[model samples]
Target chain A: MSVEAMLQTIKLLLPALMPSWRFFSVIAPSPRIEITLLKTAKDTPDSWQEFRPRPAHLSIGSMLKRMFYNARWNEALFLTSLAERLSSNPTEHSSQEILKRIKAELVRNSFDSFDSAATPHLQFRLVFVHREGEQLQKHVTFISPVYGSFGDTDS
Target chain B: MSLDYAIRLTEILLALAFIQQSIEHFRAPRDEQRLFIPRFILSILLLFGFQTQWVCLALVILALFILRRFQGPYNGGSDRMGLLVLCCLSLINFMPSSLWREYVFGYLAIQLVLSYFFSGWVKIKNPEWRNGQALRDVFQFSAYPVSEALRTWMNWPRLLVVMSWSVILFELLFPLSLMTPTTLIIGLVIASTFHLANACLFGFNRFFWIWMAAYPSILWLQQRIFIVEQL
Candidate 1:
């Protein structure tokens, strides 16, 4: 196709991909995803919720904050669940055992269920934010493995 | 201060900055040695331009200033030879493997072109730009630390996007635009805005200033300054 034709196609699709230009104009708007994560952590009493909300900007520091926060929640729950399954008391389980359990949990949750090739091995949660007029609302989903081997074959 | 003084001061500042960067590269830890090589090479090239080949570098810098100042042509030897040399040095510093050199150069070229093209493409693609909303968007978004009440009066997204897109399209077509006076002026205006935005938003102060110094001269004032030899 000609350059002009290709540009026309892109022009048609651009608005769908980009937020309204007014949205970009705001100076340091609050992060919708981070707020959702904070609310989710607060609701889950069984899991450790020591994660802090990162500043609403795209930077290396913010990326690290998100990574650590996700890992912390995933690790805590995986260990707790493993202790229960093994018929061991939670207080009796060692930190090393917790880490092993978390790894296993990740393998089970991610391996066969999702397109693991495109996804990183690290645990992540998706949050959706809905905006109505001037008001904003958020929903968070936490997903992971039940119990299984690390390989790709489904059980 | 005079333009000559301003240029001289800028050259000295850039030379010092590059030297400091080169020192930092050398001081990086052993584990970080691989990452430093490219930086180290760039530092060496900048240092060479500052110390030994200052004349050629200065000429290119001066060429840029001249283009911006006169808006038409000026008289002098064309700095094309100096530019060619710099380009060659940039190539060698990145070489030994053609892949690495191409990857680096290609990425920069793609970034320059895409930044312009995508911006323009999006603008022209939108109906709001045609209606002058794009300009209003620019005024609103560009408001500083505290926004003025005027933002409420502007068509925030439309105005900004249109202006931004115009810049990108102009830049993408700059090489071709060099042949005509009007197109060259449009390209320079777009480039100036791009550099200005980089300085304001990203704090790429030196790069935005120094790199832009070359464009006006190279694109707009080439014919007025020096005689072209027929090949």
Candidate 2:
């Protein structure tokens, strides 16, 4: 075909190719969070009340901060509990010293929100889970910014 | 020598560019707002040389009609009417505040003028451009992967310096060249070459094509270059 005819044909076909190109590419995931506003009541029996579900979009950076805070707190809590349990056991292995060192390293390397001089707002909780025959895992959960009695649903 | 060749070349290139962009947009129609879909479709039709594409083709025809209407001796008042309508359309189609779009359009409207006048102004501003050293610096700076090899070329600096000053002088005096045929041709040839160089080096393919297409109109103002003769 002539160059002119070929060019004309290509122009007619371009729009059909773009939709599929976009579908297979990376899609940004939205961060969802439940929020509650604290309110003071004068005439009501309860002084403070929990608000209903108020969802706010959390940015990825903020989400990562919360995750890191939770992980560190959980690891510290786990190590403390493990040390206490081992101390109560009379027949603890000689290698328990090495285990304690390993636990200390893990706790040290993990994120710490409170270093005495650190701001109170930076403090976070990390939950540690010990499974039988499996490695210990840490999960970070933030201290709810909204205070005055908000309970964790899973807890 | 034929008008047909020029028109055919324009049509083919325009069609190719439009088609490529249209296909890209079609595959990702969501990239643009949904309202732009019909405009895209119409653009595609225009590229294909379909009768429906006449809507956009009418815009160019309308511009020509307005130009012809204002230039003649019939009615002086009609020129103001045409100008008013043009101003209204321009105002209506005004794009929102965007630095990038502003630069793109501004660059398109006056690249040749700036290349000539500003380059000339710089030559006058400094003695280096007039003496040829400024051109040498430009060429040396432009030497990419071969900068080391180019550094060894001895007389290139002198030649480039002269050429650089010539460019500035040419640009500075280009407006006066428009008054005469020979000077106009010389000025346009230099400007065209400058734009062509920009296209090859910087990949400003769209701007190059648009500028080249408009170049004929500058010549058309001087003499009828595309009149068809009875064969």
Candidate 3:
């Protein structure tokens, strides 16, 4: 089997091995994983529910992936910068170009951290929120992930 | 009377829900585009009413992986509930002849009842939800887009308390809906209206449709399967 298939199998089995529950990506004062591992030695498999891993929203792997993703926001502003530019321009051709640029940059930068079997390939969307008086009125959205589709709506 | 009829109806409603949600996702496709391809594929299968069990199972599994990868089962209760429904459907498809089908349906029915119970129980533990302040605070937020009329109702603490308690009581008593077919129909109607109101008020359209899709399973368990098994 391929590595991807192996990883998928691991994810499915993880719940059984660990506890199937909900957990915050970041637990205040200390990480959930740290606490879970510490507690695991003394507790039975069923006792993991106290750690609260919401399988519906989070799994052991995904929570870590999100933490890593968020951690890199400061260092990797390439996508966000492009998104800002695209949102400001809010044009069809520019949106497409920004998307192409992002894909190329992802490859060129050798952003290997996010290339883990666990992490997902990122896409970008540019959203423009227009105002009616002081209140936000509408949204003009340009999506790069859908091959550069544009959507506009009065929110 | 047969499980076949219930399954067919559930499948159709689920298909429509998937299609509707897929369109919304397509509008502002997830940040992880490649990972979401399985979701796109599953939507197609569901929309066409594909009954190919193995293929549907593969697609559902793929979709779950994508959800895991994106850390998006975190999106909200809807994604979680949708995954549950899909998982249950796949299990039924995979083991068509085994008692596994009944077990899975029973599991779903129990989970459905638990969803409401736990939500109500959790809220009742909170002071805000108990006193109606939760609704009042929720409507005051711009994210929810409350109408001026609804927003004004926040000032009436007594009314808010009544509304809140109504929700709390109904949700707490939801499992009792399983007692009889008549109660089940009445409960489902009230629950459907609750979801509808939530959709209208909170823009939780996905929850509205997907929860409705799960109704057939609940109906099957309460009216048909559970009755037979109890005897």
Docking quality tier of candidate 1?
A: incorrect
Model 3 per-residue lDDT tens digits across residues B78-167: 666777777777778877575778787666667777777766776677776887766665554323322334456567889879988988
* Best model per TM-score: 3
Give the candidate order by descending TM-score.
Answer: 3, 1, 2
Q: What local lDDT does model 2 show for residue B104? A: 29
Let me know the TM-score candidate 2 reaches against the reference structure: 0.32
For model 2, the stretches where C-alpha displacement exceeds 4 angstroms are A1-155, B1-115, B142-155, B181-183, B200-207, B220-231
Q: TM-score: which is higher, 2 or 3?
A: 3
Error of 1 at B108 (Å): 8.8
Worst 10 residues of 1 chain A by lDDT: A29-38
Q: Output the number of the lDDT-best candidate.
A: 3
DockQ for all models = 0.03, 0.01, 0.03
- The residue-by-residue lDDT of candidate 2 on A1-155, one tens digit each, is 57764454344222221111121011111111122222321112222221111112434453334321222222222333333333344223312322333323323533222232221111112232222222323332222222222222111
